[model samples]
Target: MSYAVPTTKKLIFDFIASRDTVSKGELLQVFDVTSSSLTRLLDEMTTEGILEASGFGSSTGGRKPILYRVNPIHRYIIGFEISRIGSSIFVYDLQLNQIAHVRWKMDATMTPDVLIHHAANQIESILQQHHIAPSQVIGVGIGAVGPLDQTDGVILNPLHFPADGWKDVAICEQLTAQTGIPSFLENGANTALIGEHWALRGEQIKHMLYVHAGVGLRSAMMSDGQIVRGAFDLEGSFGQMIIQTDGTRLQEGSNYGALEAYASIPALEKQVRTQVKLGRDTSLHPYAPEDIHFDIILSALADGDRLVTDLFHQTGAYLGIGLANLINVLHPERVIVGGPFMNADHSVYDTVIQVTRKNIYYAPDYQPTFSMGILKEDAVATGAAVMVRKAWDCE
Candidate 1:
C-alpha cells in the first residue's frame, strides 16, 4: 500500500511516551529537526489529541519550554496471555492503565484451539463490559508459551501442552479475523520481561534477566533497554538447557534432566507426589497425594511441613546452579524471578535467593540486584498490551 515512511511525529510521540514529559528544545536536539519543523510537528500531534502540551518546563535561558506528553485516552489495546493456570485478556488505555480484565481456567486441559476461542471471546466480552466499541481498540496482542513462529503468529509445539494436534496454531490471524483488528504475538517470557521493563519505565536500568517458573521454566534477558530476541525468537530457552546428562524426566523429553524438569511448579508437584508415594510425608495428610497441588504444598510449607520446605530447598539449589551460570555469563544488573513459582510463599523465594548467592561466581559485593516480579499474575497480559502500544504507536 506504500504508506508514507515513518514520520517525525512518530519519533516525537515515542520520545514523549518514554519520558514522563519532554520539551521542544530536547526534541529538536535529539530528533535533529529545526525549531520550526519541530514546532509544526508537535502542534499537529497536539491538535490530533495524540499528544498535548502539558505545562511549561524549567527554562535554561530563554522562555520556559512547553512540556509535551501522550494523551492517555488517545487509543486502547487488548492483550491476551494464557498459562496452565488459565487464559486471560486485559484492556488497556494508551497509558497502559488496565481498563478491564477477564480470566478462565481449565483444571484438566489448556489445548490451543480451546484457549484461542475462549480468550478471543473473552476479549470481546471485556470490551463490551467496558462499553468500548470494537473500533475504539487500535490492536490486540498475545503472550502465549513460545517456540513460536512469530512471523506467522503460530504457536509451535511447546512443552507441557496437549500431546497431539498442537502445532502451528495461527493465533494472531485467528484473533484478527475474529475481531477485525490487527494482532501481534510474543512469547510469554519475553512479554513478562517487557512488562517488568514497562513497569520500571526501562530508563534507569539497561540490563535485566527475568526467570519464569511455571509448568515450564525459562528465562528472558534484556540489555541496553532491548529484548535479546534470537534469530528465531527463541533466545530464552534456558529451561531446555541440559543440567544433567543422566537423570530422566517427563518434561521436554529428556533422558537427561532439563532445567524445567528440576525447577518448576509441575516438577515440584511431581516430586511431592513421588515422595508421598514412597511414604515420606507429614502435614500434607489432609489432602490425598493426588490432590496435592503446588498451592496446597505451599500451604503445607507455611504450616512447617519439613518435607515441602526441604523439597523447595532442593529445587532452589538446582535453580542456583542455573542462575549461577546465568549471572556469570549475562552479568545483568538485576535478576527477577516470577510466575506461579512465586505462589509458593517467601520461604521458597528466600531459599532460591540464598542458594543463588552462594552459587554466583562473583564476589559478595558484586552481586546483581535480585527480587520477585512486582507485576504479579498479570505481567504477561500487561506486557502484551505494551507490545500493542509499541506496534501501533508509530501509526
Candidate 2:
C-alpha cells in the first residue's frame, strides 16, 4: 500500500516472479511504455540490488538479451494467520522460501489487547531468533477470517473469536504501530487462494477457484490472474447459497437449507453425533458422547465404519452440488478444495468430484481440474507474505 513504489516497477517484479526468468525484450513486448522508460526502471532496480542479471536469454537475429531475476536473500517478509483456535506466523525470503515459523493455540480468554500483544511479541521473537532486522523486513501480512473491510484493513466482528469488545479492529494499523513494520490484511480464504496461485505460478493459471472446507465452507476466485473481489469484498458467499429447499434447517426460522447446513465440517460431525444419540452403534466406542471429534470420525472411517462413511458421503454430495453451481457460473479452469476436510479418506474427495461432474451445468468442454493445495496448513500464511510483496513492490 506504500505510495512510494511505482506500479510499473511492481508489474515488472511480478512478471519476474511469474516467469522463472525474463529478458528485456519480453518486458518491452508486454508493457505499453517505450524501451527507454523500461530501461531506466530496470537500471534503477538493478543498481539498488533488487534485480540482477541472471544470464543471456535466447537470441532472435540480434545479440542476446540479458535475463533478470530477484535476489532471494535481499529482503524478507512475515505472514500471519490469526484464528480463534490457532494463530501462525512465518518469515519468508524474497523467493517465498520460509525462513522461520511460530505457532500457538489461542488462549480461550484472550482479549483484543492481549491478542495484539501476543502477535507483536511473537513477530519480534521470531525476528530476533533469525537475526533479522526490522529494517530488512518488507512488512507484516495478516490473513484473518473476514466479515472485514479489506480496503481499509479493518477486521469486523469475526464469528469464532470470543474476545470482549472485538469490533472493527484495525489489524493493519495496530500491528504497524506496535511493530513499526508495514502491515497488510486480507481475507483468510483469499490469502489461501493467493498461496495456491503462487505455488502454481509455473502453471500459468490465469483463473482458478479455491474452496476452504473447515467449520464452514468459504471460497475465493482468481480471474485473469487477479482476485475477483466484488463490491465490499463480500463476493464469495457459497456457504449461504441454498442447497436443498426441504432439507434440514441449520437454524430455526430459516427458509431454505443452506450449503453449510449439510456440507461443512461441523455439519458432518453433527450428523454423526445425532446418529449416535439416536442409539446407532459406532466404531468410536471407547470415547464418550462429549468426546466425539472429527479425528475420531476419520479414524472410524479408516476402520471401514459404515456410519462415518455415510456421513462423509452426504457432506461430499452436498459439497459437490455447491461446487457445480460455482463452476457453471465462474467457469474457472481449476477448482482447488482444501482445509481440514482434506484429511478425510479419498472416498470423500472422489465422491465430491464425481457428483460435481454430474451436476455441472451444460458445458461440454468446461472441464475444471480439481486438486488439493500442497502447502496444506501453510498456504494462507505464505499468501499473506505474497500480499505484502505485492503491496510494497520495492525492496
Candidate 3:
C-alpha cells in the first residue's frame, strides 16, 4: 500500500524561513513529525541544495543535532520598480542583498512594447553584469504604478504612464515570456510597506501601514506581517477616499475631494504654480514651471521659504486627516510615511502630527507610533526582491 506524502518538507521550510537557524529536533517538535520523517525531509532538501547543514547545536546531555539553514546562494530573483519619473531594476540573492541595480529615465514617447523590451534588456544586462546564471534566477517581482490587475499582471490605464499605452498590458506575462522566468506584480505602495516590515527597528512588527506621497498618494496595509491585498488588489487605495466634500475638482479616475488631489506632488506643484502665477511674494517665483519639482520645493522650505513652508504644512494636514481615518479603521501599530513629499522639512511632520492629533478621536490618548520609512526610495525595489524569497518560503 502506498502511503501519502507528508508535508514535512513544507513544515521544515517554513520553520527555517521564520527563524535564522534551527535544529533537527526542534523541527520535529514544531511539526509533530517522527524523527524518521523529519530526517527524510531534511536529507532530501540537503541533497537538493535548498537547505544546508550548519554547525552543531548546543549539547543536552547527549549528541548535539546539526543546525540547518536555508541556502543563500541557491537562487536569485530580479526586482523591478516602475515609477512615474523612471524605472529601477535590482538583482537580489536569497539573503535579500542587492547585488546589482539599474535605473533610467522613462521615455514619454516609447510605447508599452518598447518600454517593456527596454526593461527586459536592462534586467538581462544586470544579470550578465553579476555573472548570475539564468537557471538560478527564480523569477521577477515588479512593483509598478497601479490600478493593476494583479491576477493577470496587467497595468490598466495607469495615469503616470498614460502615453506609454499601459491599457490592458499584461506586463508579467510578457516579461515572463521574454525572460523565461515567473513574474509577480504588485502595487508600488504595497511593496513599500512590505520592505518597511522586513526592515523594522528591531523585532519585526506584524501590523503596520505605509503611506507614500509622490506624483500620487497611496497607502498599503500589512496585518500579521502579510500584505492585505484586497478584493482585486485594491485594498489600500486610500488616495480615492473623499476627505473634503467640496474641495478642488477631482482629476479623472479620482474621487472628488480625495486627499491625493490636494497632497500629491503634482497637486503641490499645481498649487505652487498657482501661487507663482498670482505673483505671490516668494523665492519660488524665480524657478520656471519646468524647474519646479518636489526636491526643489522641499529645499525651498528647508531654506526658510515661508510660502513653501505653508504649502507643505497644508499638504501635511490633509495627509494627517487621511492617516487619522486609517488609524481609526485599521488600528495599525505603526505608520510609516515615505516618498518625495515626506522628505520635506520637520515643519511638514509637525503639521501632520498636530492635525492628526486634533482630528483623531483616539488622538494623543492612543496614537499609533509614526516614523519615516527606513528604506525610503529603495523600499519598493527591496520589497519586490524580498517577495521572491517570501514566495519560496525562504524569508
Best by TM-score: 1
Displacement of the residue 119 alpha carbon in candidate 1, Å: 2.3
**TM-score of every model versus the real structure:** 0.91, 0.90, 0.90
Instruction: Provide the global lDDT of candidate 2 against the true structure.
Output: 0.82
Most accurate candidate by lDDT: 2
Give candidate 3's error at residue 316 in angstroms: 0.9
Q: 120-151 in candidate 3: lDDT tens per residue?
A: 88878887887887788978889988888887
lDDT of 1 by residue, 1-395 (tens): 01245567776776788888898888877988889888888888888888877899998888998898888787888878866566788889887888988878744455666666777788778877778878888888788887888777888876565434567788889878888778887888888888888888854788999987777776889999888877776623676677888766755455367776788777888899889888885777666789988779878788888999888879877877777778888899888888667567787778778878887887576789888867867888898888777766455
Write down the lDDT of every candidate, Cα atoms only.
0.78, 0.82, 0.78
lDDT of 2 by residue, 1-395 (tens): 33454588888987886666788988988999798999999999888888888999888999999999987778999999976556898999887889989888765567767788888998899889888889899988888877788768888876546556567998888888899998888888888899989998888899999988776577999999998877765523677788787777665443368887888777887888888877787776666766787778888889999888888998899899999998888989888888777558787888988999998877566688888876768988999998888777574
The TM-score between candidate 2 and the true structure equals: 0.90
Worst 10 residues of 2 by lDDT: 247-256
Candidate 2: where are CA atoms >4 Å away?
A: 1-6, 33-36, 58-64, 107-111, 162-166, 251-256
- lDDT winner, 1 or 2: 2
Which residue pairs clash within candidate 3? none
| Lowest summed lDDT window (length 10), candidate 3 | 1-10
Q: If ranked by lDDT, best first, what sequence of candidates would result?
A: 2, 3, 1
